[model samples]
Target: AQSVAQPEDQVNVAEGNPLTVKCTYSVSGNPYLFWYVQYPNRGLQFLLKYITGDNLVKGSYGFEAEFNKSQTSFHLKKPSALVSDSALYFCAAVDNYGQNFVFGPGTRLSVLP
Candidate 1:
């Protein structure tokens, strides 16, 4: 079985400050981790992914993620946050079979100016 979790239901950050959204996963075999963001009434937008190679993976919108195999964690980070960055963040992981993709409950990020 594969599952993903976002312990924080909401994250608040000041503009231009660093931000992080934590994510953890439990899966068999090598996990394919991904992060996505969703705006109001908008679909999920791809942010970053971790498949292999480097533990750190950079993605769109100046966002990056660090994959920790030992901890089974893939946390999303940004050097500086923006008001427009406020949205719903989701963490997902693909199962070993790659047929099922488990998604987290989601975390709402609020970037205040």
Candidate 2:
């Protein structure tokens, strides 16, 4: 079985400050990791993904994540956060086998002015 975890239930950041949301995973082999953001009453929106090549993967909304094989972690990061960035973030993983897609509980990000 493959699983993902977002240790923080919520993350608070000041507008224009750098922000990060932690994520760790467990899987049999190399896993395909993903990050998604959900706004109020909206479906999850794709943020970024790590499949094979590069360790650092960049995605929409000025978001990026680094795939750390040693730590089994893929934490989402942004150089500067905005109040509009406030939303629920989720980390997900699919094993190399591609049999299952598991999602983290989700971490709420609040960017204050």
Candidate 3:
């Protein structure tokens, strides 16, 4: 079984400051991790992914995630937060045998200006 965990329900960060959203996963084998963002009343948009290679992976909109195999964690990071960056973020694990992906509950980020 593959699953993802998002420990926080919401995160608050000031504009121009760095922001981080945490995630952890459990899978049968090597995991394919992904990050996605969803705006209000909108569908989720792919932010980044970690298939293989370096532990550090960068993705869209100045977002990056570090894959820690030992910890089974893939935490998302942004160098500078923006008011517009406030949204719902999700962490997902791709099933190795199928095209299905199991997503985390979600983490809402609120950026204050």
Candidate 4:
């Protein structure tokens, strides 16, 4: 079965500090990974995706991720986190044989000022 797991309920970070929300996925074949962010009462906004090639993928809000095949993990990262970065983060995966995607419950990133 294809699934995405976000082990953390939330990540607390101070302004200008680095922050990370954990994510791991499982699929039958190759993985098409994506990240999204959501603000209060707003639709989710796309961040990045890992389809093929380089494991290091960058996205909006100065975010990036490293796709690891062996571990089946795609962890989002940032050099420095901003207070505005506080929001809900979700990791998603497209089914190898199915077009629909599976999403993690979501990790709330709290970037304190």
Which residue pairs collide, candidate 4? none
For all candidates in order, the CA lDDT equals: 0.96, 0.96, 0.95, 0.91
lDDT of 4 at 100: 65
What TM-score against the true fold does each predicted structure earn? 0.97, 0.98, 0.95, 0.95
In candidate 2, how many Å is residue 54 off?
0.9
Residues forming the 10-long window of minimal summed lDDT in candidate 2:
1-10
- The regions of model 2 sitting more than 4 angstroms off are none
Q: What are the candidates' C-alpha RMSDs?
A: 0.8, 0.6, 1.1, 1.0
Residue clash pairs of candidate 2: none
Question: 41-87 in candidate 4: lDDT tens per residue?
Answer: 99999999999999999999799999999999999999899988989
* Candidate 1 lDDT tens digits, 57-83: 999999999999999999999999999
lDDT of 3 by residue, 1-113 (tens): 67899999999999999999999998767889999999999999999999989999999999999999999999999999999999999999975665558999999999999
Taking all chains together, the TM-score of candidate 4 against the true structure is 0.95
Model 2, residue 18: what's the lDDT?
99
The residue pairs in collision within model 1 are: none
* Candidate 3: stretches off by over 4 Å: none
C-alpha lDDT (0 to 100) for residue 81 of candidate 2 = 98
Query: Once superposed on the true structure, which residue ranges of model 4 sit more than 4 Å away at CA?
Result: none
TM-score of 1: 0.97
Per-residue lDDT of 102 in model 3: 91
